[model samples]
Target: MIVDPAARRADGESVRIAKDVLCAGATVRLCLPDGPEEWAKALAKRGERRPVVVGDDRALLRVVSLLHRERDLAGSVLSMVPVGGAVSLARSLGVPTGAVAAARAVLDGAERRMDLLVDDSDGVVLGGLTIPPLRDGRGAARPASPPAHPWLSTCRSLVRGFTARPARAAAPDDAAPTRLRVEADGVTLADLDHPVAGVSVGPAARTGYARVEVHPALTAPGTAPPPSPLHADARTVTVTGADFRYRADAVVTGPVRRRTWAVRAGAWGLALPPRP
Candidate 1:
C-alpha cells in the first residue's frame, strides 16, 4: 500500500481505517512517502505487489501516469481508495468513495481491464478529457464527475470540492468559447471558421473507442447553446487551435496548438469492486 502524503495530512482517520482493513485481509507492505522522489522509489521497488493507492484523485493520477511512463501500467492492476475531498475522478472510474469500502475493494475486487487515452505528448487521460471545460454559473469548469452528494452542487471548486486553484488571476476568458478544429476518425466535427463552446472526449463504455462531442458557442446571451452539438465515435480524436487549455483526469494541462489522443482499448487494468 502506498499512502500519499497529502492523504495522510487530509484525513489521518481514513488512512488508518484503510490500512487496518487492508492489513486484516492480506499481507501488506506500507510505504508512507513524504515527497514524489520517495514515492517513485517505493513504486519501483514494489516488484510483484499490486499497488493500492490511498489518497484522492490526484494521487491516483500520479500513480497511473508514473506507471504509464514506465510502460508497466498495463500490468500493474492498480487500485485506489478515495480518501480526500477531491476524489470524483476515482469515483467516476468505479472506485468506491468511502475509505473503508475502497480498501475492501482493493482486497476483494476483481481486476478489470480499462480503456485509456494516450496523447501525442505521451500524457494519459483516464477520465473524460474536456477542451474548454464545461462551465458553471460563475463561468468556471464544473466538477469533472457529477457529485455523488446533493450538497456538492453549490461548491464551485474546479474538480468538485477540490479547492486548489491555479495561480493565475482573472481567468474568465479561459472558460469562454474559443476556436478549435475538432476531428474524430478523420472526420471534421468543428472547424476554426466557427468557435466552439466546449469539446468533450472520453472512452465509450465497452466500445473500445472514444465518444466525441463539440458544443457550439451560445448564439445569444442567456440563450441555451445550440442543441445537438456535433458528435461522433472513433478510435482517435484530434484538436487543433491557436492556443487552448484542457482538463483531464481532473487536472489542467496545456495551451498547446494541437493535440491528438488515441484510445487504447484495454490498455490498463484496474481493481474494482465486483459488480452486484
Candidate 2:
C-alpha cells in the first residue's frame, strides 16, 4: 500500500518511480489523501496482508497507528520507501535514501518484525518527542500546528533565534520547561522540575540514543546536556503532569498529561533490500 499525500506527489520523479515499480510486477495500491480514517476503513475491508508505505515518516506512523488500533500489529508486516520531506526518522531506521534503492528494499529485502509504541490516544512506531525551543509569535510552539511550507518552517525556526524570551525563575533559564515524572517498568527514572531542551524515545536509538534528557533553556546554555536513562529495550514509558509538547514522527500530537505508552514486541514485519 502506498499511502501518499497528494502534495508530496507533486514531484514528477516520485510518480514515475512508483509507476515503474508497479509495472515491474509489484502489487501496488494507492491510498489517497481523504484522511487516515478513510485509509483505515479501506485497509480493514482489505483483510490481512503485509503493508508497505511509500511516503515519509508520518505515513509510516499512520500505518502503524492503524495496525495498533485494529490490534493486528503482531501478525502484519510494515515497510516504507520514504518519499517526502522529514524522512530523517526513516534514515535513522537504516532504510535506503534513493527511491530506486528503497523500492528494491521493499521488493527484495528480508522481513523483520520490530517493536511498536502503543499509547492511549495514538500509537507511533518511530521516533517520538524532540522538544526544541518554542518559536515566538511565529507559532512553532505547538506541534499540532500544521507545518509551514518547508522553506517557511526553516525560516521561522531561524527567526525564533533572534526574538528569544527571557528565562523564568523555576527553570532559571526562562525556558518553559515542564515538570514530568517518568517511570518505566515500575521504576522512577526522572522526577524533577527543570527546563527540557528535548526528549526522544525509539528503538532506532543506538549507543548514543537518549531515553530522556533535561537541559537549561537554550538561551542560557553553557554546554549541551548529556544523554540520560538510555533504554535498550524499553517496553513501557509514562509521562505525567507536563505542560510540554511532543513530536511523534513528523507530527505534533499532544500537550496532555498522564500519557502511558507500551511497546508491542515483534509487532510488524518491514521490507528491506537483500544483502549484497
Candidate 3:
C-alpha cells in the first residue's frame, strides 16, 4: 500500500479504514513514505507485489508513469482506494469511492489487463489527445492540464453549471480553415484545410474506454465540417502540422512538427473491483 501524506490530512477516516483493512491482511505492506520517488524506488525493489494506491488520480498516474518507465508493467496488479481528490480515472474504471468499499474490492477483486497508449516519450494508460485553440501562453493547439483533485474538478463543473454563458455566434471570413492530413492503416481520411474544432482517437470511445481526442480551433459558422470517423482501435497514428501543438493525457508536451502514437494491448494488469 502507498499513501500520499498530503492526502492523509484531508481524508483521515478513509486512510484509517484502509490501514485497518490492510493490517487485517498480513500479506499486504503499507508504504506511507515521503514522496513519489521513494515510493517508486520501493515499488521497483518489491518486484511484483500487489500495489494498492491510497491517493487520487494523480497518484495513480504517478504509479503508472513509474511502471511504464521501469518496463515493469507487464505483471503488476494496481489497486486504488481513491482517498484523495481527482479520481476521475478511478471512477471511470468502476472503483468504489468510499475507502472501506474500495479496500474490500481490492481484497476481493479481479485482475484485468488493459491496453495502454504509448507515445514517443511517455505512455498513458487512460487516454491522450491534441486540442486546438491554445489557452494562456501556450501557442496554437495544446493539451489541457489534468485536474489536481476529483473534488476540484467537481467544483469546476459546478461553477460552470451555475455561471454558464452562451457561446458567441460565428461569422464568415473569421479565419481560413487550416489544412490537416490524417492517415490511419494506410488510409487517408482528412486532407483538407477547413475550420477544425477538435479531433479525437480512442478505443471503444463511445463506450468511454481509453481513447485519444483532438480539439481543433473553433470554426466560423457554416465552415465547420461534419463529424469525422476516428480509428479508435488503431495500433499506430502519425500527426503532423505547423499550426498545432500536442498534448497527451491532458499534459501538453510538444509543439513539434510531427508525432506518432502506438497502442500496446494488455500491457499492464490493474487490480480493480468487478463492474456492477
The backbone clash count of each candidate, in order, is 0, 5, 12
Question: Each model's TM-score?
Answer: 0.82, 0.69, 0.73
Candidate 1 global TM-score: 0.82
lDDT of 1 by residue, 183-259 (tens): 99899999888778899998785558999999988655798557778878989999999868898887888878899
2 versus 3: better lDDT goes to: 3
Overall local distance difference test of candidate 2: 0.63
Ranking by TM-score: 1, 3, 2
> All models: lDDT?
0.86, 0.63, 0.68
Clash count for candidate 3 is: 12
How far out, in Å, is residue 60 in model 3? 0.9
What does candidate 3's lDDT look like per residue over 92-200, in tens digits?
Answer: 7677888888888788889877777776767574654654533323224567798988899999989998998965544432333345665554455455464345556
Give the poorly placed runs of model 2, Cα more than 4 Å off: 27-33, 45-49, 131-174, 193-197, 204-233
**What ranges in model 1 sit over 4 Å off?**
133-175, 219-227
Top of the candidates by TM-score: 1
Q: Tens digit of lDDT per residue, candidate 2, span 1-276? A: 655765256455875685577448666666565686787875675565456677777777777777777877667767787787778988877788787787777777788666566677765645555544333343235556767578888888788887877644344233344456666656765565544444456554533222544343333447655445334335677766645566766677666767777776666667766647
Model 1 / residue 203 / CA error / Å: 2.1
Instruction: Indicate the residue-level lDDT of 178 in model 3.
Output: 47
Residue-level lDDT for 98 in candidate 3: 88
Candidate 3 wrong stretches, greater than 4 Å: 128-130, 135-179, 205-232
